[model samples]
Target: MTDHPLRYDINLSILFTELPLLERPAAAAAAGFTAVEFWWPFDAAVPDGSDVDRFAAAVEDAGVQLVGLNFYAGDMPGGDRGLVSWPARSAEFRANIGVALALGARLGCRAFNALYGNRVDDATPEQQDELAAENLALAAKAAAEQGAVVLLEPVSGAPRYPLRTAADVVAVMDGVERDAGADNLRLLFDLYHLTVNGDDIPAAIDAYASRTGHVQIADAPGRHEPGTGNIDIDGHLAALADAGYSGWVGLEYKPSGSSTDSLDWLPRARRSSS
Candidate 1:
């Protein structure tokens, strides 16, 4: 296996679905990961306090760092990606800010991903974009208060979702930074989605790595673990390192079989921190 210079973290939400949510951090630890990230682990816009406490405890007990998290994206299993751009759901998104920041502070997490909402039938693209910028600015301000950065990602295969290119997300990031006067907003550069969208992977790393807050990976054509499909994971990772990005590369791929069985591509040296 090639030596990857970047630090790595598993996305508990995607890779360890076979385990209970509270049990995933330990599973990741047992698998040799010292850091982990995940999508919002709640089904509702606001989860119960006890659930939050339990999650915090689970990570603490597992001795893994909570390196990144997503702000409340509603009903992920039901196909809702995020709420930041929905004008009607603006309050819901705002309500999640304090909770998210508190959790981030407790976990020493510095990266938060805020997915841009899909275009709504009742709202014009202009309206949606305007609403998204407003919410992102608010999120950026809140994240800054906690010394954390808010991230924007361009997802593929979701046509209704407006930001589908690195350029698209960077434009939104610029708007938010200008509006908020805060530099806490950055890109969540996921190579799998970009590859699926037919983006120039190497070019993207060169163009946006400096401004990227986090990076995620899965192989194209199947969104499975690396080496199971056609993405140059090593090349992009090398490019990111060359570009001076030292953030975590999140393992956000689905396993072809058991999740543990699919980790052969990750060299043991890259699995845990020194």
Candidate 2:
């Protein structure tokens, strides 16, 4: 990749799992990255304020910008995609937004990823969709207090999860915006997930580039770094650039080998946009 056009941020959660959470930020900085993102940093939805302070310190001490963060989505290691639509855990999800935003605000981050959880035995599809809309709307409004936006994405590999296509997420965003009268909701253009769901990447970017608030990537067959799979990662990035998406492109893929070694495809000079 000759002078990659996009401003790329390392996903601290996935890329540096070998290190402790607090250490990942510095590792990313050592790798020449100026920015990073993560899933919820704590197991608890609302971590203690001291813990929140520590989380903020780690990022600040590392000298890297925290560009994105996910609201708690339940036990991620246990296969829970999210709790945004789970009726049982709705309260937990809502309570975490303020803490997430405050922590994010400390790091100058405004884009938040809200995963749509797997289908729960307690709620029907209709009921789940309804709750999702309400929670998303609520989240959007909360993020708005600080001029942030809530990002919704469709993921693959979870058979029970509902939002598996770009269109599905877009529809939910549409409903949330129209019904709840919120405008801070936007699509998370994660090309790897869309490709796994068999969506046309070019068409998706063409249709929703301007509506996209964030972008993430990995390759299919195996969710590894680019060039290890068949997905045209660079070409898709080019297309995104052509479509005028001049935002952070998150490196959210599992490393093909050691995390540091996996970043070979991306030049160090291009790692830090500044």
Candidate 3:
């Protein structure tokens, strides 16, 4: 088996809602984790509880790395409703990307996740793809300046968004690389969504692994943990290895029981070398 790094998103967004951000890393370490992640840290500010400096200190104290940061949600005040697809919201999207990069820097994270939010009815598929490519190219140029890369995730079942296939992501990346002249732009392949969108997970991974900088997982039907649902997660991991993937596989799933209770499967997942 090829060597691969195993970094999970302690997903503090759901795991420790009761605990403060500065305290989540310690909690994750106590659970036998050496890395932690969250969805967004927009609210983190200076001289306060949610400050990223405090979070950085916490991670250093615990000797854990901040593996990933997903900045997908755009519901904040004055924020854009959707990124990439909306022409009117391009400025807002750029500003958000800047914030995400700064936060990643503070938390010692090198990766930031961008979303292809809902598509627009007025825009054709070609138009949406073009817009997404341009936005990602711009973001990539800025992020590369900061020593970070933007990982785009495609979500289906949502109307108006552009990315749905591995091809779409590839096209976007190609456009970004060509326009921005930077090869740091990449994709974040979520196995659960690939299953939902009817992609052959292993085949898709093999095809796009070189461009995939990060991954997320959950089971089908309910999007729960690996063993509790129907996804062939072990096989997926093996495929990831075969495809030459060497990044973190984030546990971005929801828990059926309490987060701690569902963590029983963590050891098995961590132990599996696939």
* Local accuracy by lDDT, each model: 0.89, 0.90, 0.71
lDDT of each residue in 43-75, candidate 2, tens digit only: 899988888888899999999998899999999
* Deviation in Å, model 1, residue 250 alpha carbon: 0.2
Which regions of candidate 2 are displaced past 4 Å?
A: 2-4
Please give each candidate's TM-score: 0.98, 0.98, 0.83
* Residue pairs in collision within model 3: 118-160, 118-161, 119-160, 119-161
**Considering only N, C-alpha and C atoms within 3 Å, which residue pairs clash in candidate 2?**
82-117
Candidate 3 or 2, higher TM-score: 2
Candidate 2 Cα deviation (angstroms), residue 83: 0.8
Count clashes in each candidate, considering only residues at least 3 apart in sequence or on different chains.
Answer: 0, 1, 4
Candidate 1 clashing pairs, residues 3+ apart or interchain: none
lDDT of 3 by residue, 177-271 (tens): 87768699788888887788888777787789889988888878788777877888767876787778878877777788876677787674562
* Poorest stretch of ten by lDDT in candidate 3: 41-50
Q: Which candidate has the top score in lDDT?
A: 2
Compute the lDDT of residue 87 as modeled in candidate 3: 64
Better of 1 and 3 by TM-score: 1
